[model samples]
Target: MKLFQDKVAIVTGGASGIGAAIVRDLADEGATVIIADFDEDGAIRLADELGRDRAAPFGVDVSDPQAVEATVAFAVAQFGGLHLAVNNAGIGAPATKLADIAIDDWHRVLGVDLHSVFYGLKYEIPAIIASGGGAIVNMASILGAVGWAGSAAYVTAKHALLGMTKTAALDYADQNIRINAVGPGFVTTPALEKTMTDDERSGLAALHALGRLARPEEVAALTSFLLSDRASFMTGTYYPVDGGYLAR
Candidate 1:
């Protein structure tokens, strides 16, 4: 649990769902975490609940490179330096078929899901290197590697992160900056639950070989490990923590 004692971390989208779960997991392992999210209120609330001394809040739009830079700087300023980052803030595409998808929808999803990862690495890489190297986990999805119909934008954006992560890892391998991603299966987060119909929600449980959806904490555990020395030998890999969903 003390794997991260004295370390500093930042988690984008830390206000709720998988992001919030990651924040809590990091804190539990004794890391000083910064909750970076556009949801200012939720960020502040989580920070308070996690102990203000151990957690701080920063409001940011990950798609904005300037905001990402500021958020990284804030983590360094508040915690001495940043050693870990979880770039998890992202948005879903408007549910539509490829032909029906608008240009704006493509841009929007790519902005939050793909470009944000680039923005994060732009600033976070330098900061982590200055701290003598660290780990980073990008939030990808099972859709990142597979095709999901009716989600052209989402599918395209997520698939791109896989390449991004690999290219980044190849360039930074000797620098000790391990960059990876987690491809999660269906997870019953507040947002996901709200958007799915009762039938759709129930049916999704069977999509995984395990016959159930993931818990936020389950994803969080893997994320915490990936960001620590415990996963030192791991890098440039996309882990499918999807309950065997990909096997289908």
Candidate 2:
């Protein structure tokens, strides 16, 4: 049998990039997935490509508690139960120094990157418990461990996300639910490709010991493993698929 056969999963921000890759991997392994994202059309396209029976599209603003709750409920109502989840929704703040960061930008970054994860945990946990138990992966970043200039909001949110992941994992460990965070370094996603010049990309890649940005599939592989029985004994841990970026 496939790793996630008979499992049901939800991947927020799943229409593209790393989240989309995770959705594909899970669905390919036999899980029914809900592609939740602010990009409704993109979600629909991905879901259609995966086949309607294997995946469904959910339009949601993860920052909204109501929308997040509805997403968890949708998984159960649509697929019968919830078994896995990836809170992959996030946004970057503008390149502003701490003193120059706008209030709205700070709140916006926190709302999507940090608060959304909290909302996911709050709703996903109860559903998972009701379904007997499962696993969850929160998509964090290298910023969670280290700081970056002019990225104070994003950095702060990521650091807090790691703490939340650890605490939630501990809280639900005895209940057979596994919770973990994934910290990825400079992934080559569609958005990055569109905005970054070759030189800019090269500069970021040089920061990693691997001398290359990570592929979305690389991150997806780790996420799928964590959500599967292969990682049965793991919980409350932060796994960094950072291409040795933090090694230095």
Q: Give Cα-based local distance difference scores for all models.
A: 0.91, 0.95
Worst 10 residues of 1 by lDDT: 93-102
Per-residue accuracy of model 2 over 1-248 as CA lDDT, tens digit each: 99999999999999999999999999999999999999999999999999998999999999999999999999998789998999999988658999998888889999999999999999999999999999999999999999999999999999999999999999999999999999999999999888889999999999999999999999999999999999999999999999999999
For all predicted structures, in order, the TM-scores are 0.98, 0.99
What TM value does model 2 have? 0.99
lDDT at 14, model 2: 100
Please report, as a residue range, the 10-residue window in candidate 2 with the lowest summed lDDT: 93-102
In candidate 1, what are the lDDT values of residues 25-99, reduced to their tens digit? 889888889899999999999999999978999999888889999999998887789899999998896579888
What lDDT is reached at residue 156 by model 2? 98
- lDDT agreement of model 1 with the native: 0.91
